[model samples]
Target: MLSKRQSKYFKSLQLKKYRQTEGKFLVEGAKGVEEVLQSDFEVEALIGTSAYLSSLAENLKSKAKETIEAKETDLLQVGTFKSNNTGIAVVKIPGQDRNVVEEKGLILALDAVNDPGNLGTIIRIADWYGIKTLVCSMDTADVYNPKVINSTMGSFTRVNVMYADLKDYLSKSDKKVYGALLEGESIYKTDLTDGIVLMGSESHGISEELRPFVTDPVKIPGRGGAESLNVAVATAVVLDNFFRG
Candidate 1:
């Protein structure tokens, strides 16, 4: 059973301000809770049904500072998910001091991708392509957003997402900046290489400020009449081309 204070605390994490204040975020649903438990991320607390708690290994159960047993209905009230019968974990947000750009591998970067779902899908896409790091503009959606975390389907555990000034980050790096633009060279023909693949918002595409830094502007050829691709799909398409070679 959850105390009123405890329930309130967990509920507060659903908002970004509260999450930042607490240095913690909620990982809802059974799969997300399971993945966070397995990762190196620190688990502050675990809330689940008695059966769900019992299903966890002793070592996994011990990872949390505290554990609370609750009914499925109780779990539903504490998280953003529409359904959560299994469990939810209060996880400490890891420090974001690591380098986003690597010396030898391709890095995924985002510019003003404010949609949580799009950001989350892109994180999964980055994980799929084995791209370890993702740099995002400060305006990008928070990676710790519950919707984003839920959308990753556990890929959030594997991908390193850091936010910074997109323009500045690109300017400091010597690697080629491949901007996904509609009028640019078709991604199918461009010579892909290791560098930053900068994707912009669905509505705005790449911002004008960041375009000057793009050493290579590439695009996906569209035979149909679609004006633009969803940022997440475009990212997967671009990454597929990069890793195809």
Candidate 2:
């Protein structure tokens, strides 16, 4: 059973302010909890029903500093998930210093992607393509937001997401900045390379400030009658082209 104080603390992690202050975030659901346990991330506390806890291997169970048995109702109340019967793990946020940006490999960068779902899907997409490092502008959605973490479906454990000044980072980098834009070279036609694939927000395309940094403005040619593709979908399309080329 979870103590009142512990329940409150776990619930507080749903908010960005509390997560930042505590340097911890909540990973809800069985899959997410299991992935976090398997990853290098530090699990501070694991809260789950007795059945869920017992189902885990001894080594995986030992990963948590503390484990508490809770009812299904308790989990639903403590987490952002609508239905959480399996578990929720309070995990320590990894230090930003550990993410070292390299100039050689393909790196995905986001600008003002405020949608938590989009950010989460992008992380999963990045993981699928085996792109390890994800750089986000300071204004991008909080990666640790429960919505973001949940949407990743455990891909958050594999992808290293770090927020920085996009402009400054772009200006300093010698690698090409392939900005996804409406009026730009078609991704299929352009000679794709391993560099920074910069994507913008859903409503607004790439911001003006970051435009000058885009060495290669690329886009996916559309044959359909859609105004624009969702940021996450666009990312998957662009990355697929990059992977193929």
Highest lDDT model number: 2
Superposed Cα deviation of residue 214, candidate 2 (Å): 0.8
Per-residue lDDT of 126-245 in model 2, one digit per residue for the tens? Answer: 999998999999999999999999999999998889989998999999898999998999999999988899999989989999999999999999999999999999999999998782
* Clashing pairs for predicted structure model 1, backbone only: none
- Counting clashing residue pairs in each candidate, in order, gives 0, 0
Candidate 2 has which clashing residue pairs, if any?
none
Model 2 accuracy (lDDT, Cα): 0.93
Task: Please list the residue runs of candidate 1 whose C-alpha ends up more than 4 Å from where it truly belongs after superposition.
Answer: 98-101
Stretches of model 2 off by over 4 angstroms after superposition? none
lDDT of 1 by residue, 148-168 (tens): 999999999998888888888
Relative to the unseen true structure, what is the Cα RMSD of model 2? 0.9
Candidate 2 lDDT for residue 199: 99
Candidate lDDT (C-alpha), each: 0.90, 0.93
